[model samples]
Target: MLLRDKFCLITGASKGIGKAISEIFAKEGAIIIATGRDLESLNLMVSDLPVYSAPHLVFKMDVTKEEDVLRVFNELSQNKIFIHCIVNNAGIMEDATLQMVKTDLIHKIYNTNVLGTILPSQNAIKHFLRNRCGSIINLSSIIGTKGNLGQSIYGSSKSAIIGFTKSLSKELAPLNIRVNAIAPGFIDTDMIKGMDQKFYEKNLKAIGMRRLGKPEDVAKVALFLASDLSEYVTGQIIGVDGGMII
Candidate 1:
């Protein structure tokens, strides 16, 4: 049990990669705090988590809203729940060409992807600084690194995450806190399922493994970062893209 008794807060935990990370962390003996915008889906997800001595908890958290993020953190403090790590997995993807992008759409994407990550991290980092130990695992994307045809806004937002991860890692490493980011490739999630069949097949051919990566694949890497296995690692951008970039 790599994370026995550890408390892990995973955002956007109702589906896809976030849900997979929450389940895997629970199976590894971590007490899970699963949060998302949808209370019902979050509840459903928590109900199925692997049981442990400390039952998994669920909260409706809109990571983009400062009030929502603060309220949850406050409640955790009130309950004396000290999290060992926080996975900033709450994010959204809206694709459009530069000319087709609207100002409102830009705000929407940045609000969810950029500010969404920062608010939770700001709260988590405060807690980590006080404890002198914690892990911050952020989700970036391979699209952010290798430019895609129709993902300028999404790519820039994820790229911001990579910058945040590196800067924060350096700032807190001296205090014994770690921060890192995972840039996953075209994962087989709702985001990818809606892709045109031709585009999907093209991606498969581009991937060295000739297959789309699974949510579990990203979750497994997340587990390593959350656990002691990555105690010495920080300020790194880990690519979970199955050799797609190589």
Candidate 2:
């Protein structure tokens, strides 16, 4: 019950790592506000979360759209639901080599990965400032820190997240708010499920642990950052990458 009675908002919460985080947080007693583009999927996921004193909510949000992001915050405010934590877990990845990458693809990647994180965070910061206490957990990727082939656009977008997390953490620390980023490596998720078989096996060899990480593995680290356990920890990019970089 590390997050007992806390209200946590998780974006892109319909599937993969985001869904995993939602489940774990709910089990620990956090009232989850799960958002995603698919309303049906979000509702289905919410239906499965562990029950708590405060019921979980499902919102259809396209993280790339500022209007969508603002609407969710406004609606929550109208209902007097003050979120204690925000996990910017909404993102997309379409890996392409430099030559194969197109301008539209780059825009798509940045909008969802970079602007997606920033908009929700910008709105969350307003609420956090009033409370003078909050937590913001951003999801980065190991590919951002350690460059990879055929993923230039996707990697750069994640790198932007690292910068955003570091700067915001410093700005909010004095107010007792925390901002941290989790850079997970090659987790078993839909994002990586489409890789070529040989490419997939090659990635397996790159991990020191000799196994792909599970969504729950990343979720546990997120739980730490969202709870009192990480009160003294901020502005850090934690790698849930199974020593992939080492």
Candidate 3:
């Protein structure tokens, strides 16, 4: 229970990696503020977590909406729950080649992936700065570090997130808050389900482990970054890619 009684806010926590992280955080004795767009699934997660009773709070939110985010934060603040860590994990992937991309899709992906990240980070920082002690973990992807065909839009958004994390770390270092990014490769989630066969196989073959990453792999890194174990680590990008970057 390295993070006993800590309050963690995780975005996109209805299913997949987000939900997995929430459960892991809870089992580590952290109270979770889990946000997701699907109310039913969110409720299920709140009930499914392994922690003791009342360790989780679920908020139905669309990460792209500033108003929704603001309202949820306000509600949490009013309840007097201090946020100790924030995980920015909400993202949407819409892939198309440079020439084949639509203006509308580009805007949609950026709103959900980029702006979705920026707004919550800004909001969370307010709470973090108040305590002068907190951690912000941005969920980036290996695509941001290396390009793949038809991944221009998705990669760009994630790249922006990683870039933002680095810059934000410098800005908030004096406040005693750490900011970092985790670049995960081909995790077994629906996000990877859409990857072209050739692209997925090429990446898997490149991995020294000869396997795809799991949500728990990323969740473990995130837990370390969120806890005091990473007190000296900040403003960096770590890959949970099974040595693919090697």
Candidate 4:
């Protein structure tokens, strides 16, 4: 049991990489608290999994709202379930250069991607500090580090996330609360499910693997970071991108 008797809170767990991580953690004997905007889809995930069907708590949360975040944390804490891991995976992308990006769009993206990471992490840190043992794995992106064109708003949000994770790692380390970030690249997801093949190929060629990454590929590394395996690792950005940058 890699995460024996642990409780993990995974945001954006209705689908994609978040869902993948939740499933992996649950199988590792960690009770999962899964959050997403869509309760129906989250419930569907719960029904589909064979891990007692209810180890995943479906939290209908809009990560942008601080009150909702604090409320959920309070509710979960009241149950006496000490959280051992927090995966901040909820984020949105506004694809456009800085000049072309709308102010409103920038606000929306930051609210979720940046502040979403902030508020929830604050709450998680509170619980983790009390226990003196925990892991916080934030979801950044290769876009944050490499700065791809037409991704200014999205990239900025993720870049900010990396800074936040690094600083928080320092602040929380004394309490034995480890913080880290995972930056995934070229993952095949529904958002780009219908993208043109030519564009994908052009992008895929950047990676040595010559293919798009799967959500599970990222989840495996996340499992490592979330468990005791990387307890000494903190304030780092790991690229699960098939050697794109290297």
Candidate 5:
């Protein structure tokens, strides 16, 4: 039990990597606070989590909404449910070449992917500051590091997350709070399922492993970051990309 008795909150927890993280954390004995806008999907996910000693909760939250973010934290505090880690996994991605990208779409991407991460992170920092210890694991992407076709806006949003994680890590280090980001590459998820087969094959060939990454792969790295295994790690962008960037 890497996270026995710990309380972890994960955003975008209805499916894909976020859902995988929720299950893995629960399996490791952590009480999960799974959040997403999809109530039905979230409830389904909660039902699927491993039964543990500590209870798990599911919340319908929009990370981009400041009020919603504040309410969730406030309610947790009122209940004395002190959180140990926050996984900022809520994000959105829409593909469009730079020339073909619409302004509204860019705004939407940044609002959800960038500001969505920040709102929850800001609320979590307050809790961590009071507790004097906590972990923040942010979800980024390889596209943020290595530019990809038709993903300029999405890449920019994730790039902002990388910067935010690095700076916040340094600011919160002295307070015993750790912040880090994981950049995944071509994980098998709904997002990837929508990609054209040709593009998928191209990415598959580029990956050193010659296969698509599973959500569990990223979840394992996230578990490491959230648990004591990464006590001395922070401000790092770990790529769970099967050496694709190389």
Candidate 6:
């Protein structure tokens, strides 16, 4: 019960890492607020969450839209529900070499991966500032630190997240709010399944553990960061990459 009675708001919560976070948080006794653009998938996920004392909620939200983000938070505020933690996990990735990259693709990546994180975060911090304490867990990527062959735009977007997490952690520390980013590497998710087998196998060899990570691996770290275990930690980019960079 590491997060008993805590209210955690997670974006892109329909599947993959976000869904895993929601499930783990629920099991830990947190009231989950799962949100995503896919209404059907989100609803299905809500139904599958482990039963806990506090009820969980699912919202069809587009994190990139300011109005949608504001609406959800405003409704929560009106209901007197305070979010204890926010996992900015909503993101998109499309790979292409720099020469082959299209401007529209770059825009699509930044809009969802960058601005999507910023909008909800702006709303969440207001709540945190008022409460005088909160945790902001952002999703960065190992690719952001170590550039990938065909992920120039995606890497740049995640790089922005890393910078955002570091600067905000410093700014919010005095207010008792903690901010950190988790950079996951080659997690076995539907997203990763789309990669070519040759490239995937190459990545596996590069990993110290010689295997791809699981969503649960990232979820466990997220749980730690969201709970008191990481109360003293902030402004850090923790890599869940099986020592890939090391």
TM-score of each: 0.97, 0.98, 0.96, 0.95, 0.97, 0.97
Over the stretch 59-114, how does candidate 3's per-residue lDDT look in tens digits?
A: 98888999999998899888877688999999988778989998999989999888
Tens-digit lDDT track for model 5 on 15-37? 99999999999999999999999
Model 3 misplacement above 4 A: none
Question: What are the Cα lDDT values of the candidates?
Answer: 0.91, 0.93, 0.88, 0.86, 0.92, 0.92
Q: Write the per-residue lDDT of candidate 2 for residues 4-110, one digit (tens) a residue.
A: 88889999999999999999999999999999999999999999999879899999999999999999999998898888999999999897799998899999999
Clashing pairs in 1: none
Quick one: RMSD of model 5? 1.1
What is candidate 1's lDDT per residue for 1-246, written digit by digit as tens?
989988899999999999999989999999999999999999998899888779999999998899999999999988888888999999998888999999999999999999999999889876776667999999999987787888999999999999999999999899889999999997989888777789778888889887889999999999999999999999999999988952
Q: Write the per-residue lDDT of candidate 6 for residues 178-238, one digit (tens) a residue.
A: 9999999989998877888898788888899888899999999999999999999999999
RMSD, one per candidate, in order: 1.1, 1.0, 1.5, 1.8, 1.1, 1.1
Model 2 steric clash pairs: none
Q: Model 2, residue 19: displacement in angstroms? A: 0.7
Candidate 4 global TM-score: 0.95
User: Model 6 misses residue 38 by how many Å?
Assistant: 1.0
Instruction: Give the poorly placed runs of model 1, Cα more than 4 Å off.
Output: none
Backbone clash pairs for candidate 6 read none
Error of 3 at 35 (Å): 0.3
* lDDT of residue 200 for candidate 1: 79
| Lowest summed lDDT window (length 10), candidate 4 | 47-56
Best by lDDT: 2
Compared with the true structure, model 3 gives a TM-score of: 0.96
TM-score (C-alpha) between model 6 and the true structure:
0.97
